[model samples]
Target: MTGSLISPRVDYASDPARSRGRFQIEPESRTRTPFQRDRDRIIHASAFRRLKMKTQVFVAHEGDHFRTRLTHSLEVAQIARSVARTLGLDEDLAEALALAHDLGHPPFGHAGEDQLDECMEAFGGFDHNAQTLRVVTRLEQRYPTFDGLNLTFETLEGLIKHNGPVLKNGKRMQDLPQAFLDFEHLEQLDLDTYAGPEAQVAALSDDIAYNNHDIDDGLSAGLFTIEDIKDVPLVGRIFHQVQKDYPLLDRQRVISEAVRRLIGVWIEDLTAETSRRAKRLNPKSVEDVRNLNEPLVAFSEKLDAEQKELRRFLMERMYRHYKVNRKRSQAKRILKELFGLFLSEPDTLPPPWNETAQQMTKDARARVVCDYIAGMTDNYAIDEHRRLFNLDAMI
Candidate 1:
């Protein structure tokens, strides 16, 4: 109800008052903006609750301290709010996008997604972004009048196109995911253009959160040492600075300070670069932002290169560490086996899902199976696999 105290809303920011409105019109909220209402709905969604047990980079049961999807989303939302406030964008919209961005990710992180996609290859393949749209649009069945939360059009558009346009230069992309196509039939998402400025902020905020948090997780896991990353461009320099600043600081504190500083550097660069772009482009409205050839929110050229270097370091030293690969291998096996068994025996699925799969054709049944599997948490998937595959285990 209170207006943003940080700064006035910018001309290019998405305005909830002037929102394009939800697909299924509902009475307006007296206490919250449409964007804020969308954020609240996402927070209360069952899919969002399941994120608590979903993997980020580590399995849920791997360690109590490791970040899960829920914590990661929270972090992303925090960063998004901060960045949006600084940039005078709609903080609620940015925060909502951040919270909902990863709802489509399956259990066991990218490993689970990869295995599911492989299993679904004959059934149009799986894509997380498309699945995210499906989750918000068709999968979630909370509303009595609609399947999804009936989020604002702006929120839906941002959710799908946050990374950028789905279509290339007003042209349909080859091998486009079925979920996106399905949604497009119901609502035109302007798939050929970048999303609004708030969505752009949320997208970059996601990048900032994961990049920094993974460093912390990797360090905690001992996949690599601070010394190992001491040469990784901006990351390395920040760590070195932290060490120099506090010679007696413990390892954890040093990592905490370094990661904090690194995130700050990224936020500053993103804010400055975005402001520079806005000044140059002088977008008069959020529509102008969407129609721009390039994204309004971005890291400086120098920082973008450095961030890529950091990603490369993480890819080699952390994500692909032998220990992580072992987990990935096991996760892939569990998901792949689960997909195979469920597709082969729809009766294996629980209750309504089984009934739904039984009514559909093979391709449609495969998608049903995929959805059931994709909705699982890491532990749930593992347990489900055990229940199905282990003859001695009770069903």
Candidate 2:
């Protein structure tokens, strides 16, 4: 265990003398650690389950193959794990982080989020990542005094980084080198911020998954054609990589093939570079990841470029297409009506939610309205829309 500090499972962040708020259900005596408990808590949470009903591109229930929030998260977890395990890092923590990554995304996908963001602009304003951090840290309550998953600083750090540097308390996080210093215990952490390497990989993995899957979903929904998608150069590169890395995977298997190939390339690049770097370090200790010379930087830059290009391709060809845009607009109407009905109108709201809304503050009521829409499954959101807002709602 002497040289084991270099291992990924090892908590690189200096230990916190105290991390308050324990897990609601501690894992039984086993190989699972606290982070695993954090992961499992997320896996089993009611919030996590709601992902099945949320949209990823084309809405759920429209077809079996269109991506759902759950599937997208699973893809991210799979990618993160492959990267973590290849380097002997902590796979469980990465898996957990991926699952919890999108817990704060509202119903109707980004459109619903856009409406909320605009409406709540006077408030903190909504960003999925910020909301995700809020969920695990405070809002996903199934308890009284303590809400959220109550995960460790390590896990929370992963969520924050995966979400990318945030704007919190009127500050953009990436600008501040002392991000971690804002936490409860400042001294224990070495880095001013502590987003594990796996967290960074997950952020990029999210981009990789959605870029391919969104194209597939759009085509399946008849919004675009594979030929239309192939016209984009980045799309061509993706499929090219897909065929080269995964000959057996068909064109339709874009997400899986792209993710698998990306992770493999990164791991191979990372392993070779780390090994080379190890040879150059002094006997006293290895060079920290920060000290890496140009090779690592070059690889990272290349990956970033590809990811951006791929995302842009998806945005142009599919995400912003007329067919998808029409549906997104309708879905926003559905959620907006629900927001006004359940939180603003008050009378037509469901009994339970109506009661909850009544007890909330004005701003809290609006957020509660957002949370209600966020928690709804795809089918259920439609059902609620009919029950509360539609003329045919009444029997």
Candidate 3:
């Protein structure tokens, strides 16, 4: 883990000791803060390690250099901690949020998620954010008395609503995801208000990490050339500046330098914007941050606009590139096929999954299939598909 970049604490930072304590209360760790322990628990979770083989933009076997979910989470955590430190928020809380944010994503990035959602359409639909909450709160089964990791309530709050409140006016704006509704009966997260400042920072930090890293990945994949993005927003300007500053620089070095600088630009803008909001709000505590109508952490309006334009360019150029589209189609088919086979003939599922399926209602069994598939890594899903469908494939 990267060392904290800044160390000035402020009144609004989430205090670890004073945190809303764990779901199943246990003795506190003598050596760690609550938030620090939250971070450690997340890092040590089984799902956290599963991230290694899960796709970010490219499949795990595609190349040695591409980012996997594990690497991406680490990058997001690094960026979040840096921003949190600069803003005098709880670095540990922000880092934990960043790391835990993507735990719900299935094997093949958005393609896998899209397919899973389609398969579960009649079964309350699949939502990664909700699945992440489920993974931590209901599925992990790490403790003797609890089903999940038994995380602190503060961590749970951020995990559930880091994007923003699930509620609007007095009720949820849309049907709440099943996992969230399940947990709601156990503990109520104020779904109408924003998360604390640390979660807010972690959310924006994700934007920074993916946007910049995608540029690098796209370049490496030959999905688009550096020149192709040279006319995009801030990204274009950075690329041109790098080329001018290092005329003889190698291709890889140029992309790396530009991506690094872009991350710095984003972090600078975010810190400035958040500081401006902090001054205006003068929030006295973490609760004050949540109760406020607007988020305390955010990018500046100008940067937000630039990022939108850049996203448009990437959508057309990299995300929709023919090669990636082909894989998306294949990934969707693989996940869809797996879901069908498992849901229709639950006995085919190995051991405990098959045993558990026997007792569930149709919809409940479908969800069990959904969870099983959603937890698979890219290669595991592919191999499972082959085993189920390919007569010549090894068992």
Using lDDT as the measure, the top candidate is 1
lDDT of 3 by residue, 1-395 (tens): 98855758999889887898876779999998888888898999999999999997777878878899999999999999998888888889999999999999999999999999999999989989999998998878777887878888878889888679878656653577776776753346777888888899889999999999999899999999987887888999999999999999999999999999999999999999989988998999999999998899988999999999989988998888898998899999999999999999999998889999978999999999998999999989999999999999957
Residue 199 in model 2: shift from native, Å? 2.2
lDDT of 3 at 286: 90
Which regions of candidate 3 are displaced past 4 Å?
1-7, 169-174, 184-187
In each prediction, how many residue pairs overlap at the backbone (N, C-alpha, C within less than 3 A)? 0, 1, 0
lDDT of 2 by residue, 1-395 (tens): 35542345323321222233243444343765766777888988888988987886677767777778998999888866765665555667767888888987887788878876766665446667657766675657775667777777667766765643343345644443221322343233223332555555556556656765565566667766655655554555665666667677765576556545555665555545534443454222112432322221113445556657767777887789887798899888887677666666755556776787788777767766666666677788888777665677854
What does candidate 1's lDDT look like per residue over 2-98, in tens digits? Answer: 8664767899989989999988889999999999999999999999999999987789999889999999999999999999999999999999999
Better of 2 and 3 by lDDT: 3
Worst-scoring 10-residue span by lDDT in model 1: 179-188
Give candidate 1's whole-model lDDT: 0.90
C-alpha lDDT values of all predictions? 0.90, 0.62, 0.89
